[model samples]
Target: MVDVEFRVVSDRRDGLLLALGQTVIAAGFTLLRQRMVNSEEGVVLTMVVRGPENGLLLLEERLGTHHLVNSFEASPVDASVANAVSAPAAAAPAPAPAARSNGGAPKPASDDAATAMDTRRVEALLPQLARDYPNIFIQLLALEHDLPPAQREATLRYVGQRVGTWVYKRDFSLGGHLALADAVRHIALPAMRQLVQAELQDDTLRIKNSPFCHRGEHGSSCHFLRGMLGGLLGGPHGTEGLRVVESHCRNTGAEACCFEFHA
Candidate 1:
């Protein structure tokens, strides 16, 4: 399924949201899902595609008529989403750096807010999941850190069955130790997003549902959540006019843990 995504760069995202709701409803397009995020850039709209090419065309046409979207750009669904059904979305491309017309730096608060949310976005989504399947969620994190390689693989191979369509991304390349982050991209995330939308999700972080949550017990044997959890854990860019981020945060670096299903 193709997703129509809109990202608003201006401070007045409320205007963007208004324009979006009107356009989608007037056009009779299904509002499959939407998330208003406080991103590193600014307020963002992560919208799931729920209609056809014609629906998108009509929606775009309507948005063009609105002053709110005059400067905002609408891009195709995430390349990765398409690749899931067809071809792999091309390897990630280098996004252009944010620049100032006067060739100076951006204000501190906005930049810091954006940089900080890179890691927090994942956490923001977690509360809802914790509320619903407290057992499953807690069990997963139980095995998050400090596990032997072979054992970690065995855990994921088992958890993947319960969670469904998961992906493994590792960041051990930089450090000498081996690590794994397994995410239930297709299964767990979609369900979670639905719960979030309905305001029905939970906020627990313990994995009481699965026994795997108790791997070394002292050390979280559960990297299933840790597998794809690497991206939000690294250093940031240090160029002039750039924002400073925590040393371990990879949000500004190329060392992303992974992007899987957000259920």
Candidate 2:
């Protein structure tokens, strides 16, 4: 048997270890040691196991495609590494450095500033958002006012992606993978209804009275919505190369905001 170590990053801790344990057993591995810790990246789970050398590929594939796994790294275990497993878990990996723009300057704050919403903060607010769904616009408007005009949409989009991914993990990560249209209908539409009036027809999602986009205005206010849809539908288990495009916006003379999902 060969020993391998896996480090997994996920948005939530609940059921993650259990699910992973099952996957490991099914992949013909014997769990040797594991560790989990809270971090800015969400939950980091490190596991060491022993299995047939040939099973490494299958194990990696399963972990990579797991809906709960945002990212993971696997490496063969060695003597020094195995010794370290007895020590306290190391800190979660630091987040990747922000991408630099032209001239080696950092991107705009809105593009790469600290995430607008982290997993913990979103988890804390979800119940309240569900309870007072209609009043969420007030909070959203407040969030808009706090951001610079140049940064508003980008910041909102970042928050949208975070929240969207969280919602998918919490609600839709179970059962099995879903196709683009089914996910849009079964996952996106219902999740959106909590915050906006949305209907799915064909491959387009129509939104009425978006809190962010006011009638008669001529600007894009659906950046957050676009980001949310992207997060919900663009993961490994979801549809790959899925794009959410806002074809029409109420602010731009449309009766509603029409977001087209192209897979």
lDDT of 1 by residue, 70-91 (tens): 3446777764663353221234
TM-score top scorer: 2
Worst 10 residues of 2 by lDDT: 89-98
Error of 2 at 144 (Å): 0.6
**What lDDT does the true structure give each of the candidates?**
0.36, 0.69
Q: Model 2, range 1-263, lDDT digits (tens) per residue?
A: 88888999999886677678667766877665677899998899998877789989999999999999999998889846665652333342222222466766323334343444333433343343334333344434544544556666666665566556656776788947887888888899988987777998787899986766762225778877887787777756588787788999888778999998887
The TM-score values for the models, in the order shown, are: 0.27, 0.50
Clashes of 1: 35
